[model samples]
Target chain A: MPKLDTAVVGLDIGGTSTRATVLTLTGQRLGSGRAGGGNPTSHGAERAAVELLTALREALSDFDPARVVAGTIGLAGAGRLLADPAGRAAFDQAWQDAGLRCPYAVHGDALVAYASGTAAPDGTVLIAGTGAITAQVRDLRLDRIADGHGWLLGDAGSGFWLGREAVRRLLADLDAGRTPGTLATAVLTELLGSAEIASRPRATVDATIQAVTRRAPVELARLAPLVVDAATHGEPVATALITEAAAHLAESVGRIRAAGAVTPVVLGGGLLTADTPLAAAVRVEIARQWPDAPLRTAGDGAAAAAWLAARDLPEVTDPAALHARLFPAP
Target chain B: MPKLDTAVVGLDIGGTSTRATVLTLTGQRLGSGRAGGGNPTSHGAERAAVELLTALREALSDFDPARVVAGTIGLAGAGRLLADPAGRAAFDQAWQDAGLRCPYAVHGDALVAYASGTAAPDGTVLIAGTGAITAQVRDLRLDRIADGHGWLLGDAGSGFWLGREAVRRLLADLDAGRTPGTLATAVLTELLGSAEIASRPRATVDATIQAVTRRAPVELARLAPLVVDAATHGEPVATALITEAAAHLAESVGRIRAAGAVTPVVLGGGLLTADTPLAAAVRVEIARQWPDAPLRTAGDGAAAAAWLAARDLPEVTDPAALHARLFPAP
Candidate 1:
């Protein structure tokens, strides 16, 4: 089921989750593993390193780790990890603990995200998952970036922003003593734990506030999917949030493109994946804003990391064909 | 010496800090005390109660606690405290711990902030301190509110919003590999602890992120002052943030006013305090949006609580004179 020593490891460490894969030098998938959030920016380096190494160890269990010739790990806020002595030390120790025998490359998520979407070295890439940010890829490297300010200060079109706006609209309606609209109803159902709590508006409102304040603020991103569901059910407030999210994403792209040429723009991250309502709205808005620019949806970021790692292997002379083989239709 | 029996204890519990004052029925300030944040929504009811009681007890120490005729405390998100059993227990215990002898009342900050300004029984009160919210006060009670949505979902023009925007602007500049603008420079200095770190852009960026990530998200509000300084120095990005803050505040006011008759609108909270850039912009925008609405700046929220407490005392008549004496010309 799996092969070793003829592959490379590709890993994606995100704010909310971590994923890893082993791929043959010719881009054949060998094995894969998934784990909880391992972003050192939020989880601290020790925990992040442990989670990351665990994911890698699990993926390699079916194969010999010694056979892996190269590896690449893509993560956001990696600069913070590299800057901290303990953070860097923990990462080094994690590799040692995992018993990896390979040349490892650690790159920021921005780099891998760009590669995940397009073969071009120059273009724009936008990600709108738990957080949102846009970067210009020039000569296969991340250049100027827009937003990505994290949960507190920015991330305008992020899942966190969408989810927060949904709760806000719900609370505003409850405060007005208005009958629950579909969006508010759905949001409350999810946030307060049941539709039965609807009759007790004050208690519901109070409980919602207490519950939200009790958890990490970033966890609000988990609520973004509810907004999408409401919008699909024709909730005006949810529709408006999607519209605003698209506008914010478009503006971020505009800011990035203002300083450089428009090669092609790639959209990435969970919030803007596939045919989701948010993604559809973003596509429409992006067209209106930049009709001449080419737009594409990114493949799996973790897969992209593996492809990037495998492309440089001696046997992988035709990286594009290898990528096609690894990522078959559908 | 301050008068006894005639005195009242009034407390203002904020997300960032707490303050308390003892006032005579005549509305003369007797003593005051301050402590760290005591908002149950942010710090949990136990910590909030401890801080609130500590501040109140500190203010009561100068005079016999038995002499207090009335006591009032105003805080945001108080509904959460009153609704949760543990939260309520904490408050009751805190009162016993403080040994306050008077019949005490706890009201939302909206009520006290309204009383802090004009004598109008119906109008509006907008606070934009550590958090932002606007309320329509009818008959001296908060009838309806707009955007008091806590740090997680709202508080758009708050200190937290301002501070977050500052750091975001800094990161944008760093991402562009451009020399720091005044706003970025000021933000980096305040956030990273030194402007000298600017010489090493990567380290500076990494350190700033580490510092921000290491602290609680809401603590971003502490960086608000740096934004003001940059705006004062004519930084365009900082100016834009102030302008946006003003718009958000004004829109919140509009939301509250839309549901009620036009009456006096009083602005409170740290960001909207007299003469701040945001305050001035809000005034300009508010005047343009509602030319006939009366506008005033609220006196200290704690002082308002004391004044409101004094007004309710049987011996206290002529509340206008009492408020005049308590707030003076400041």
Candidate 2:
């Protein structure tokens, strides 16, 4: 087994899922894998760490572990760094890259999104995925990002927000004398699998109200894709939700712009970069907000950033030489 | 004790607090008390009923059960009815409320707010107290109300929304190169005591997370007063949130109007009718949306409804007599 020298691992931890990648000296991916469940920050960092380690082991089943040198993780949560001097320091390692025994770097997953999404170490990046966020980078200082507060409080332009809004509109339909069997209701039935959980159930008579309540949001968020699909079919509520999300994303960009960022914005995340009406709505809104600004895909941005980060290794002396090997610059 | 023929008892149950009021048919208050902890809806109706009955007995301290001829309850998480119907229907005469053997009438606490705040029954009412809701009463159907989907998914234009939005904005400010010691931060500190709950010696991470998470909307709701206060002091964020809430409320009214309901509107609840900028904002927005629509307070409306409900009660011999007794014709 070749002794790994100067390899850096990057891990991205999101609320719905976690992903880890092992990058070789030349920025080539040695291994990668994904795991299910929620953010470990809410679930305890140690438990999350073990889950992540298990995931990494599974991802790198074919790779020799002795070849890896350093690891860093980007996670979503209250992103106050645990190692920082002022932090209460509840979370030391990223939930996706947990149980690190070596010198490891950890930052908010938004930072990783920013780093990998923008393809530049210093630039403004907006992540609009299952959740949405905007971050600014200048002189290695991250500043002025918007809308990454998570599902409970804030997360404007997120899939979760968009999905939930669709549910609200559906309820409004019931109130507005519209038929109950609209797109939203159908979406809900498919998600919750019972009318008892969807509509205003007689909660007082039910002993299983908690069981009903627990499934509510999941029922609601599941309606998001239906909303997107409905918008494609010209449903007003679906269109409104997507449009509202786009407007929010635009407002976030405006906030980043207000914070004195000059770099071209990188838009990354599942909801935004997907080939859907939401992505189209976002692009249109962004164009209206800033006509000339470039909006890049998160995948390209992440892969580019990963390739770029790998160039920092002493083994990869020339960036262009390595970039060609990993990805051909368009 | 003499066997009493007619009397009134009131039960108020909140998510974290409970109160009971005893009264006579003449509306004379008899005894009132409060209890700690959340609603039984979260716990399971049977368990909650036991707790409520136990608490009521502890608070009542009375020997006579025959004096209670009728009982009315106001509870949170009860949906449209305040009684634990599932428990009662399941256990028959096992519950203490059944032991009293009184005819019972149950309604949402929102109805209590309406009774306490409105002047008529036939109107639309907006209540923004600990939780916020806008209810429209068109004839006999109490249809088309908004807000109160719990603290997580929805509750726009409510105090909870305001508080949560404020926190998110403060966090955004931190990410934007600003510190976290804003007036919002001060309010949070005053509310939660400190930001280092995760580091507390006896803290469990999920519990702490849930505490903070659950408190976000409540905290946002707390921002309602702060926004009103800040408007008095002339702060931008405070003013904006209130104004935004007003707009959202106006949009709601517009939707109501679009649904072809030309009814009188009522504004009640702690947040809306409070001595704050919200009253002015709401009035302005509503007037802008529905220029000629009648708007009034909900206290009379609730009293009128309660009066009406009382008149139709099987115990009432003459409807006119009850109406004239509860409400004199102007």
**Candidates' interface RMSDs, in order?**
2.9, 5.6
Tens digits of per-residue lDDT for model 1, B1-330 = 434456888899987789999887776677888989998987999999989888977887777777877888888777767789998888887777787766778889878888888777888888898888888888778887777677776788899888877887776666556678877777777776676655545456667788888987788988898787777777798899999999988877776586334688888887776578888888898888878788888888898888777776667768888887776665
True contacts kept of each: 0.45, 0.38
In model 1 chain A, the worst 10-residue window by lDDT is A195-204
Give the clashing pairs for model 1.
A5-A67
Which CAPRI quality tier does the interface of model 1 achieve?
Answer: acceptable
RMSD of each: 5.8, 7.2
User: How many Å off is the CA of B288 in candidate 2?
Assistant: 4.9
In DockQ terms, which candidate is top? 1
- In order of appearance, the predictions have TM-scores of 0.77, 0.70
lDDT tens per residue, model 2, B68-138 = 66665555555523354675553233235635666655566556555543334555767666555666665
Cα lDDT for residue B249, model 2?
66
